[model samples]
Target: MVKQIRAFNQLKELALSQEILEDSRTKGVVTALYEALKSRDAEAIQKILAPDLEWWFHGPPSHQFLMRLLTGEQESDFRFVPHSISAFGPTVLAEGFDQSRSIAWVHAWTVTDGIITQVREYFNTSSP
Candidate 1:
């Protein structure tokens, strides 16, 4: 019975350590992504994103259009500021507000192997 308890404790410790490691890696990827976006550095963004990354936008077509502008796919002067950040499992979420446009947005990112593999973004669909 004592041996079984010892083995179970070891397994629990290993699982906890793995969770911590995953959380750290997720934070690193999301931090790099946020910095790249804030600077509008396409090269930096590309470094942290997987080559086959797909980003989904939840809103009207107008929101998708705005995302293109924000990501530099289309020419625009708007820049987003991330005000809050949180993580769950393999996903990191950022809440941002653009005071000039009076808009708030949420971006959810799925990070794997230290790279952002998927992104889901929601524009100002909720009242502040």
Candidate 2:
């Protein structure tokens, strides 16, 4: 029916709009997180993360597993450049490297429920 067609079109438009908004939000979160790394500020990182969260690096970290990756000797070297981002349900995947001049994998994040519930970092003698 014509009414059904109109409703379908409206729904499609709304879904597209939501996708755009979500993409923008994802970009914002990525930028904010990177800034936190550069600053090495724990408080700033906590601002965007939920209180109950955990990190799981693909490989083991050179150092011990930690809660917030702020305040350290080589903290300045912590950086990541995400290659691609995808969202599935409540999860967001950001696969990149904590790289600078080198392409070694530093850290990665898999955020969920609008907060970073899990972190997959591999900061060591490993390749991304």
Candidate 3:
């Protein structure tokens, strides 16, 4: 019985450790993407994102700022500053609000193998 319990505990610990490692890695990839955006480094952004990236957006069409940024059509005055970032498995959720514009935004980023494969953008909406 003691040996069985010890083995179970070891397995639990290993699972938890793997989860933490994945979370950290997910956060790192998302952070690097944001840093690239902030710097307007198109080359870096391209490297971080998959060539066949998938994107989705909700809210007003005019609120597609991230799309514009990715496409090199972003306005000079607009910026996305994520105030909160959380990672769950391979997905990262980044939320932020622009006080000046009263715009609340959430980005759900799906990363695989250190490359961002998809993004779902929400504007003026509560985080899910």
Report every candidate's CA lDDT: 0.79, 0.58, 0.90
> What is the TM-score of candidate 2?
0.65
Lowest lDDT 10-residue stretch of candidate 3: 119-128
Error of 1 at 44 (Å): 1.5
Tens-place lDDT digits, model 1, residues 1-128: 99999999999999998988787779778988777877778888878889888888887665564468545577766666678777776998988887766777888999987888998989876533
> TM-score for each prediction?
0.81, 0.65, 0.94
Better-scoring candidate (lDDT), 2 or 3: 3
Best by TM-score: 3
For each of the candidates, give the backbone clash count: 0, 1, 0
Candidate 2 local distance difference test against the native:
0.58
Which digits, one per residue and each the tens of the lDDT, describe model 2 over residues 1-128?
Answer: 99999999999999988987776675566557767765666787887676766756555444432332452444334455566656543455555643344444444455554566665665455443
Flag the better candidate by TM-score, 2 or 3: 3
Clashing pairs in 2: 57-121
Error of 1 at 23 (Å): 1.2
For model 2, the superposed segments whose C-alpha errors exceed 4 Å read 63-68, 71-76, 81-89, 95-101, 106-108, 122-128
Residue-pair clash count for candidate 3: 0
